[model samples]
Target: MTAPSEAARYSIQMLISDWLLIDGTMDNHVWSAVEQPGGDGAADPDIARRPEVARLGLSVRRAGWDQIAGWPHDLEGFTTWPAPGQTARMSLSGAQWSLVVLALRYWADVDERMSDVDGAARSRGIATSVEQRLVSLGWSPATP
Candidate 1:
């Protein structure tokens, strides 16, 4: 099989560094999203949450990646369920999907837990599972 395109490689790197698989503690370098003295302040949380998670924190509460497995690798593609006529709609392009997969696969092994008490191990499991599913469909990571 041919190697991934240049754009895809860059997407993988950017996903790991900028979004998922970030270096250092989850608390480190995070913007100040809270305020003191009865004032309200916030940071760019948009940069932190997984694409599958929304700000209401519903994703965490529900462990929301339930539908992520076998998601399509191409924007034009859809994931088919074993039962007839069931499919998961994917909004991300092939490159976007790649970036997400790599980011989750290489997420930083930090000592933190979600508000719902899910720890790094659980997070890693989700990541690894998704990445594996993608690989099973012939998608390859840009790096090991």
Candidate 2:
């Protein structure tokens, strides 16, 4: 609950959107994240959450947090990630925000090149690959 100091190497949660996070790497400051939204089946047109695992990218003015009344809010400020604006909220570790962004960028670039399929169908093992890569990069399911 202290102001983030970049030296903490802390694990934190963030809201992410940008549909490209799944099986695609994007251009910008942050590139990838693994998303898992429950009951959000493959049919929905917005994100096609079938993969449940993927890359990341954000369209934020800044990568770090802006505390409002003592809570973190996205740079644009209205909590956009919830409405296809933020596809999911996830937890990951970083000694610095730049490192966090870089980790995601690296993972996204790698994941995008590594996976050939679009939705990570169970048959292709893309989901497994994504999960493994994310874990190797220090990503994990957010603790409830």
Candidate 3:
């Protein structure tokens, strides 16, 4: 695949940053608020009402692969889906390398937040949400 353009790299970085901030805030605060209220049924409406949570949810839904074009087909075997695990052995332009690194970072951040919420059954929704976002970006756990 062709290397991502400079503008594409910047856009992916911005998206990764936004996703991390929103997801981190949710992990630190909103999930706790939801669990405090008996940890059952749907997520607390009040938690969803928080501006940051609302924005984060919206951003996840809106995320797409438009800026990514296509990921490197020559990636070292998938470590755990979207993340490439290690840098590609083949030559890649700087833009392509940045894209891969940023994507892996994003995956790690989301996975960490998923683990944080794994203890609560109701909180599994957060993992589902992350999975949906990854799917929207054309990633699947089934990817080889």
Error of 3 at 21 (Å): 23
| Model 3 per-residue lDDT at 131 | 47
Q: How do all models score by TM-score?
A: 0.32, 0.23, 0.23
Q: Give the count of colliding residue pairs in each prediction.
A: 3, 9, 0
Q: What's model 3's TM-score? A: 0.23
Best prediction by TM-score = 1
lDDT of 2 by residue, 1-144 (tens): 433332233333323433223212323222112232354434335364223222223322223222112223454643543354342333323323233343344454544677833432321343344345455665543411
Q: Against the correct fold, how does model 1 do in TM-score?
A: 0.32
Each prediction's whole-model lDDT (CA): 0.36, 0.35, 0.38
Global lDDT of model 3: 0.38
- How would you encode candidate 1's per-residue C-alpha lDDT over 1-144 as one tens digit per residue? 433233322211112222222222222322221222234223334444433322122312121134334433564543332234333322233444444444444343433433433555545664566566566655565432
Model 1: lowest-lDDT 10 consecutive positions: 9-18
Tell me each candidate's RMSD, in Å, in order: 12.5, 13.7, 14.8
Off by over 4 Å in 2: 1-15, 18-81, 86-95, 116-144
Error of model 3, residue 112, in angstroms: 0.3
lDDT score of residue 4 within candidate 2: 39
